[model samples]
Target: MCGIIGYVGADGALPIVATGLKNLEYRGYDSAGIALNNGTVDVFKQSGEIDDLTLPAEHSATCGIGHTRWSTHGQPTDANAHPHTDESGDVAVVHNGIIDNYESLKSELSSHTFTSETDTEVIPHLVEEHLSDGDDLLSAVEATIERLEGSFAIAVTTSGQDGFVVARQDSPLVLGHGEDGNFVASDVTAFLEHTREVSYLEDGDVALVTGADVTVYHDGGTVDRPVQTVDWEADAAEKGGYDHYMLKEIHEQPQALRQTLSGRLDTVTGDVDLELDLPEQYLNSLEEIQVVACGTSNHAGQYAARLLEQFADVRTTVEVASEYEFRGGRDPWRTLVVAVTQSGETADTLSAMRRAASAGARTLAVTNVVGSTAAREADDVVYIRAGPEIGVAATKTFAAQVATLTMLTVYVGRQRGALSGDRASTLLENLRRLPGAIQQVLDEEDATREVAYDLIDSDGFFFVGRHLGWPVAMEGALKLKEISYINAEGFAAGELKHGTLALVTEDTPVLAVLTDGAKPDQTLNNVKEVESRGAPVIGVSSLDDTTKYLDVEFAVPDLGTLEPLVANVFLQLFAYHVADALGRSIDKPRNLAKSVTVE
Candidate 1:
């Protein structure tokens, strides 16, 4: 993963690119660099945080491109930092993804000298060759892209060129139109502070930015891309009153879930009108459902897998997107592949969805981003509608994803004659109650904070659950370890004694999801097992009279099968408070990116 920020305006370049780099640092912070064109191109870069990259206090240049990298090709170093330039340093480039044919391209360009071991260096040299042949900046970059093979979002600026050229194939790039400037970045947040009027560039799209204006080209012809104002304001990206974006997002879950459920659910008739393109014939013949995702998305897929199987009676399986194989003796035409990604640029998820698509499986993208690659390429898309999640550690998006997939499940089940009207009605009713249930949990944050403070010194944490609660437990552990950096693991309640019991100690706190639908009675046995070893048990329970068993109990309001998902808010608050207590970088944890754009 990497970040790209490019600007062409009347103002100085250094401050614009520098501030943009800091704003997008969460995307990639390993190494940072900026290439400015002030009659002559000058590059400033370092293999450290954005703050470590020294730059001129003031620059007269009106255009520049910057990059923050999360090392894909070369290791993070000053030489490996981007804005990789040509021999004369006249042509500079900043890229967000990998160059698949760099070795071959590097061998071909034997006359040119390379300073870094990065694949991105090939581009500037290729552009330099094109420019030396009397090609213009846009033509040079277009020619350079012809020789390049792989997923990349590139921004190139030349000393002699009045503007910069940008192109994207697989990685994301957004164009922002501001009052006095035009911007190019990997995401909206990179330039959200300057402008909300933006347009998403699709695959094979290229653009040139010059002095408050942008011209886009696709398929060798000029294209007029529609520019729309973003829904959320610049200040929404800020932490607001919270200590970290993670905490703010954790508390924003109720509103986020409501947004997901809004205008989609019909509680009376149990009908879910997502208005998808999937036909009744297709839904009737859909024999298998494959959910493809990575990391937290994979956990959400796991949760959705259970729901799909139960609701639609479909043979459903969850696969970590990278490891997904499309051909497995299954009838592709009868299979439905669901790609779940919060940021639709996850390379592995896109690759997996592509494989499934090429095999003839109808693919659906369930994502929060509106114009993301997944949304653009999928056969159909269901928006999660959780607007503007800025936390590197996902909170509201996870709940929103689960809710959206549940609605999809209901829709499919109704179409396939798997779910009765009463059954769907019941599920919809419970789904509608989700936000209120989570709010009840959010109200108990003070108690959850106390639990976090008490367990702050623990050696490790164990999250255990069963049934629908399984993925919730896994997600709970993921949140704690991601932000707090605690040694946390989640397991099926029945599996704790298989081999995990040996690791339990008095210093370890067991977080048991003993809710109404999680098979609480069986999980209580594991709770007793951990309690026998003197481990403190923090139970998320709906069952009454569990006071004697749990060391710290967070009562979950009953929402039937959805109660386990409700318990997740407490876990999020617990992780936030623990990370806060340890003075951790909860928003941007070390060595983690919000979007993984490289496979």
Candidate 2:
């Protein structure tokens, strides 16, 4: 995935576009570049982080486009950086996503010269060819897009043209309607400081933007797009007072949970109402529930799958979206497919949802973004309301996703008459107290930090649990590996002795999640298996007796099935403190991006 930002305004475009690139850099950071247009187009780029890029002082252009690239077509180098241009250097372009048919297009345009080893370089040449044939800038862009065969969000500017043309297909692009100017970017955060009002572009929509206006077109006809105001303040993207974005986001979990639960749950009646627009009959008709997600979101889906089966009595299955196959002769009718993604733009999950739709299954998207492609394309949507998560490793969004999915479980259970009113009320009361319970865990961070210190020098880590705790274990291991750069593995506690126990040693610490419903005795036995092998045991549980067997213990709130959710917070804190102690890049770990928009 790459980040793209374009601006047309009275203010100098270089500074604005560069600032926008900095804000959107979480999406990509391999290399950075920009194209400015005054009387001529000037392109500046380098093969490093955006902060390392240097710009010339004399190019006083009022309009430009910038890009922060996560290399896909070629290696990360100055020659492969973006803001690619044509032979005459008249047309400059920045592109996100891939151009699948670039090779064929390049073969067809043999007369044109190419400089960079990127699929994006073909775009500017194609646009220049169309312009030479007397096509307007918009028509040239449209013609060039028609020849491309993969997902792309592209912005192009010509030397003589006073404005830019942008188009999107199966990729994200948003237009900002500002009073002083107009802007376009891959994410709203790019221009959020300058404008809160934005319009989302649909697949195959092309927009022509100038300093004062933006005109959108689809299929050769003018189209009107609705503009929505964003509620996130610019400061929300910044690390308020925390040492890192991950730590700040970890501390913001309470507020994030509050936002997710506000107005959706009725405390008195214990009724769950979501923003989903589906009818009650549609919800009740579900014969099975299938959840598709990836990484941490997939773990959240696993937790929800358990709730759906236990509370709603529904036959639920959780599948990794990238591996989900729809052509395996499964019935589509009476089946509901729920796609959970924090960014709402994950490539594999989106592709899986499209397959589900093609298979005639009713689809619902649970996501954090209001206008993300998944939310727009799914039959129904439930917003996570987690706000902007800047860290590459997910913290608050994971908690919010689990809470929202729990609410969804309750909603479906109530609709299907599987949960009695009294039981539902009891569950709702516990759910309401989750925010405070999570805060209690945050208040006891010192204990987690001390555990982190003890394990900071460990060669590796082994996280093991059962049932819902299984997914929690997977999430914990993921956090440690992602942020702390530790060699970590997660397994069902029962599976440990079967194979993974062979890797256990005194220097390898085993972290056990001993929570209710996770078969504590069996897990403790597994812990003792490792302890007998001389491995240190770090236990996370509500039972004080666990302290007898554990070398170190981190206590968690005893909330039944909810215990795993709260215990996860302790793991997150441990990961953060360990990474902090190791001096690792907790927020932007190497070779990782915040969102995976490409397959």
Candidate 3:
């Protein structure tokens, strides 16, 4: 939702901090600011895009921190932009996440003069009140983190101190070590130009950086964290002539899917091996299953639930993560809980998994992140191997989740003797063909992107499908709304007449996933319902005979059963392109965060 960068070096700090913030512009922000540690703390803030703010020549310093914020608690304004200062204007803070208890903190600090309408302002003052006479910067930070509530990745500088004190909880922060000094940023890209080596700070960790050394602490004790060497070239974060990251990501899908499936699916074994070393009997004995997630991952869970029920014969239920903990507490035991999260730190999903685990049910986490809390806490973990998905509206991760879950379905089904050897092998072969099928769809980007362009001026989108494809339609609507900011709804093809058909008008565009592998005639009948209303229909399917109802046909690969899953990747690109064309922020749409780490 926000980007943070901090640097301490022999060179001046504003240029280094600004360059870091510029590199992180793809994350999306409503405003930008920086705090420089000259003799006294100097802060400059602006209420617009990072590029819109001009760097001042007089702001000279050797240490500094910068921020690009997506507003959550307050409206975007110059005063509300970060690098917020203490009431006395001695300490300054740049924060990348929500401060959940800010209201209480704000009321408590009402006796002191306040300047900005921001939760972030509470941070500087909290530090102001807590920094002891003899305490070091790290101790002050640790003390502040304990007092605060909700997620945050904060970098602070004080007039009394010489270096920056950085802390992270729920929000992400990393330390970048360089030749002349040390740095901190929300993600590795913030300092990629200067250093590829980065140490990801876990929740409740604090880092204190001097010009020559970087030290980290956790729970009031000093600790050494491992540095994760990023595989991507620095240029991967830069747009290689592409207009936007969303566009680049759309084009990168073919390679992305190949990367995701590389070593995960083994054809010779006739099993989609996650290699997760769980008891086969444990999976075979599952009487019921619950799929928990939010946003795009939730849509993937919908499809996964169907696949689990169909292949493994496990009764499956899909629930939105925030509601799942309360709703699922009433479900019986012996039920396997599967939590899907691309980042793994999704707050609601994590909470739901914890509640389920505490209730004595075996829990599994399906995600792309390797060390995310979901991976750390789950009884078993299946990494999608999608590799650093930066775009906020998920592309490869969605496809990878579907592919990984499909394999898990087959694995569980095989364990329970639910499917014959020939059937399982055939399904695995179809699964292996998905990456190429998606590549075929990727080649047709011009056609799909054109449809997105035509719908850019429209206010609403309707996606309709049936059976397994029904969830795909809902996911398509979600992707469109997530990035494009359009009003989108998905309905079962047959259920459109039940109430939703009235929303379909000639000006509205209706996307129909007509590739009803299981219910072809019913899907066609559903398409006819929207077409009769004169709504423009974009049919996404592998079937060749869709000439009757479709205004524009987005043809997918002929992988048969696997096409329903692969078709989702194409819809995501369509949504992304539409949003990009509308000049919407595709990566961090207003009021949305990539990881909803707080409720």
Candidate 4:
């Protein structure tokens, strides 16, 4: 998917649209383009970043749409960049998400001269044909989407029309109500600097945005979406004195976890009071909990699965959302499917939630967003409460998600009579102290930076752990690969000798998780396997005895099964320092978007 920005207002549109595109740069893109409608449409586009894009020096266009494309239809090329126009250059369209029926539509419009190898080109041409049929730009866009099939959010503008028209279908689109102009974008962050007052657009909804106001249409009738004021400042999305957004978010984990656990826990009764609407009967009757997620969220699910089984006596399975399919043997009435996504709009997770709901299973969304598709569509919702992680590589959200799931585990455990009050109280007390523990890890950033600088020249990296540590290992490796662009892998410690041991070398470094609940003895034995091969070992350990066996050791606070999470902070800092030293784009990694809206 990509970023989209549209504006129709009294002020010049080019500046607003351009700045919006820059704000959305953290989403990751291959090319950038903008289309302005003065009397005739003027398009300026390039195959690289917005910083290098050259536009008109002077233009008075007050209505326009801009795009930062990630190259879904064609390879990154100047001709393939967005603002795809009609043959006569009458209409310009910028789109996010794929068009499934573009090939057929292109074949039907053979007489139309296409300029780009993109499904987006067909939209402007189709809108042009409708405009030729005496339809206004809004009507033309409405008709154009009716003939297409796919997940998309599109912004369209024409030479003859003053305002822009935007439509959403299985994709995210929001409108920003500003005093100077009205804005449309793939997300609220695009226009947050201009106006925090915004409204979300749902599927099958289209809106006409103008200098005066926003008029939303659903199906065929007018609708009013409530405008809410965003609580965060525009500069929250900015890196606050940190080298990169990833580093800033990593340090913010303590506060993020506190926000997630705030006012939801009672150590005395061991109860969690969340907004989840599931009945007490359903909580007790739950035989299995299937978590569907992708990427780092999937790792969070994996980590939470163990807690659920151990604390709640419930069978738990973590499935990658893209490959999720309910087994036929499980009773739908007793099954609860949890969709875990940092961005509630994750395409695969939303689709998996729908699949489970269609099969009569109860659904819950564990997301950071309030009105996200997953939050809206699921039967219940549990927010992680980690605000606005602008880094493409997730840092704070992972910690918050695991913390939230841990609270959910405690709530279910107590509800099902699986855990005693004393046991619950201890966990709650530990949870209360989690923020301070994470801060301890953050305080060791200087040493972690030293170790990272030393390991930057390693041939490869391997992160290994058992049980709870396995998921943390996976997440650590992901951070390294995502930001440092290193060749890294994570696996169960016991499985190392099976085949992975052969890949170890003197130049390679092995980071082992030797935490309390992850069976440190077995992992310690595996650490010896790498040490024998002359590989440097960096240990994230809670046990003092294991530190002697490691070449370098990072101590984590003792939190029983939660030590790996504190250890994760050290890993995040390590990844950040390495990426920073290498001069890699830590906040916006190449070829990766902050949110994957396309499957």
| TM-score of each model, in listed order | 0.63, 0.62, 0.62, 0.63
Give per-residue lDDT, candidate 3, residue 35: 89
CA lDDT for candidate 2: 0.87
After superposing candidate 2, which stretches have Cα over 4 Å from the reference? 1-237
* Clash tally for model 3: 0
| Best-to-worst lDDT order | 1, 2, 4, 3
Tens digits of per-residue lDDT for model 3, 1-599: 57889998898898999999988775545689888997588888898889987678756689999998765445567888888988877788988766667778889978777788777888887788777455556666677888787667899888867789999876678898888888998777788888877788888888889888888987668999998666666656454336566666666565555544554454665666565776767766777888999988998898888878877788899999988863444444558899999988999999999988988888999987655689889998887755456667777778878888888888888787886667777778887787677778777778878888877888698887887788888988888988888899876788888888888898888887866452656787878888898998888877768778889888767665667777776788788888878888876778877788997
lDDT of 2 by residue, 243-326 (tens): 788998898788678767765677566688684666778667777899999999999999899999999988999999999976
The CA lDDT of each predicted structure is: 0.87, 0.87, 0.79, 0.87
Once fitted onto the true fold, the runs of candidate 1 whose alpha carbons sit more than 4 angstroms away are 1-237
Worst 10 residues of 1 by lDDT: 233-242
> How many angstroms is residue 467 displaced in model 3 relative to the true structure, after the best TM-score fit?
1.4
Scored against the true structure, residue 360 in model 3 reaches a CA lDDT of 83
Off by over 4 Å in 3: 1-237, 326-333, 516-518
Q: With candidate 1 superimposed using the best TM-score fit, by how many Å does residue 548's alpha carbon deviate from the native?
A: 1.8
Clashing pairs in model 3? none
Residue range 1-599, candidate 4, lDDT tens digits: 47899988889989889999998775545689999998789999988888988988778999989998765455567898988989888788999866767888999999998877777788988999999999998899899999987667899988867888999886678899999899999877788888989898999999998889899998889999999887665555444336677887788787667657766778888788775667779888889999999999999999999999999999999999999998898889899999999889999999999999999999999987655688779988888867667889999999999999999899888888998888888888888898899999998899999999988888889999999999999999999999999999988999999999989998889999999878888899999889988999999998768755689998888898888988888888988898889999877899999999989
Off by over 4 Å in 4: 1-237
